[model samples]
Target: MRVVLAEDLFLLRDGLTRTLREHGYEVVASVDNGPSLLRALLEEKPDVAVVDVRLPPSYTDEGLQAALEARRRRPGLPILVLSQYVDQLYANELLAGGDGAVGYLLKDRVTNTEQFVDAVGRVAAGGTVMDPQVITKLLSRSQARGMIDSLTPRELDVLEMMAEGRSNVAIAATLHFSESAVAKHTASIFAKLRIAPSTDDNRRVLAVLAYLKR
Candidate 1:
């Protein structure tokens, strides 16, 4: 339950720290940049790391690179990266040498606090978690729809947006509704899809297999 969080934005970092602590996680270290993140990975020896793909200095893939390097030094180091968008290439690299215990989720998913907390625990305990967006992009339309059904037309649309990693704000804009309305749709989608509460993580392990095989 010990965590090291790496995010450059102050508000997000603070929010994540508060969220995790509130859920009974011990955040041993919270740093902003890639180099610092890498160092903390080694120094803190935390149970898990919640990282952002972009970081200070180069502001490109530094945080991801540092995470990779940190894992290189210590294989199977649990890590859960949060991103604004899905990056298949980055995901492939992170999952390269690990047996499991890694996750890549969109920043939007944070709004579902229970799911977010579940993801951290799962990764820290050596489970693989993938964002729905990554799963959708890495999959063909036909291939992706097999496991999901029973959703209403509206719910399906909502689910598709969720798969694309759209935040409520973005979804609202696209669907022309209030953010709260989008949230309601998301709840319905989760319910219909059988994405149970924190117990399962629904953090489906299949997406990792799909990414690996791709």
Candidate 2:
């Protein structure tokens, strides 16, 4: 797939480009600033764009703003945003856009080459891939709310494991409960969170994140 990379760090940009290329992805263009990155997106129309959360000049949310702009310009273009730090506010903004094919992951996660590449592919395929850290922070915030208070201690344990990306079978084994019981608890947690019964796992994760961010 064709990709445009936006990052201000020279070493990181070069390394990431090399890695992506080695993985068979074409690096259409790499830019150091947000404006130029946006220009490249318009010119290249890459299948996906990998961006750093910070860029030149402001070094704040410029990359994120560019991602938003790209979404507006080409609604189907996939975007994967990497950051040195986890920003719940920024995560909320990205999800607020509504459309899928968006990802927010930590830069350090790039070290897991296979996982990182897989995440890129998932985003390109219009799926969401979020860093586990993002999920942890959101879960922590959710736990603070009285929403979780309604849950039984065992149910809370199940929810925590789910936030950790554990499957029902895994959580059941860990908690010594049957898979059916775990599923029941998961359903209950979803109900308490006001998540629709039809919500997919990824969206459930995002809903959990949103609840935590709230």
Candidate 3:
């Protein structure tokens, strides 16, 4: 897979490039700032772009914005965002585009080379992979509303997996539950969360996001 990498830290950038290359991914371009990253995306049209959540020129959400812009320009281009901290706001923004080819994880996750490479491959293949920390934070913040408190532990687990963009089959496999059981839990979650029964994935995602932002 061809990738464009954007991170301000030289050591991390070099290490990432070497690791990804070792894993058989071509690092087409490695940039240090948002503007340069954007330019590289436009010029290279890589299969995927791995970016830091914070980049030069303010070091706030520039990288996130660049990733969003890349998605806007190339609707199917996959993006994986790495961060030193968990930020629900950034996660919301990254998934707002409603494209499935997106991932958000903490930078420390890269130490697990196999998992990190798997995440990259997943995003490139039009899938979503969020850090467990991000999912936990969103779930905790949403639970503060007392609404999420209504859910059983299993129901809460189902809802959290849904928020992570997992399919019923995938959640079932992950939780070691039957597909029918997962479906029931998902239905229960939607009812408790007040998400109308719908086949639309984006609506479900929005419902989960609304609960998180509450």
- List TM-scores for all candidates, in order: 0.68, 0.78, 0.79
Q: What local lDDT does model 3 show for residue 51?
A: 91
Off by over 4 Å in 3: 88-90, 109-111, 136-144, 196-207, 210-214
Candidates 2 and 3 compared by lDDT, better number = 3
Q: Please, what is the whole-model Cα lDDT of each candidate in the order they appear?
A: 0.74, 0.78, 0.81
- Error of model 2, residue 28, in angstroms: 0.8
Worst 10 residues of 2 by lDDT: 197-206
Location of the lowest summed lDDT over 10 successive residues in candidate 1: 197-206
Q: Candidate 1, residues 52-167: lDDT per residue as tens digits?
A: 99899988887888888999898889989898866667777776654778888888766788879987887787777777666665554433255455567776676565543345
RMSD (Cα, Å) for all candidates, in order, is: 8.3, 3.7, 3.2
Ranking by lDDT: 3, 2, 1
- Candidate topping TM-score: 3
Q: Name the best candidate (by lDDT).
A: 3
Off by over 4 Å in 2: 109-111, 136-144, 149-182, 209-214
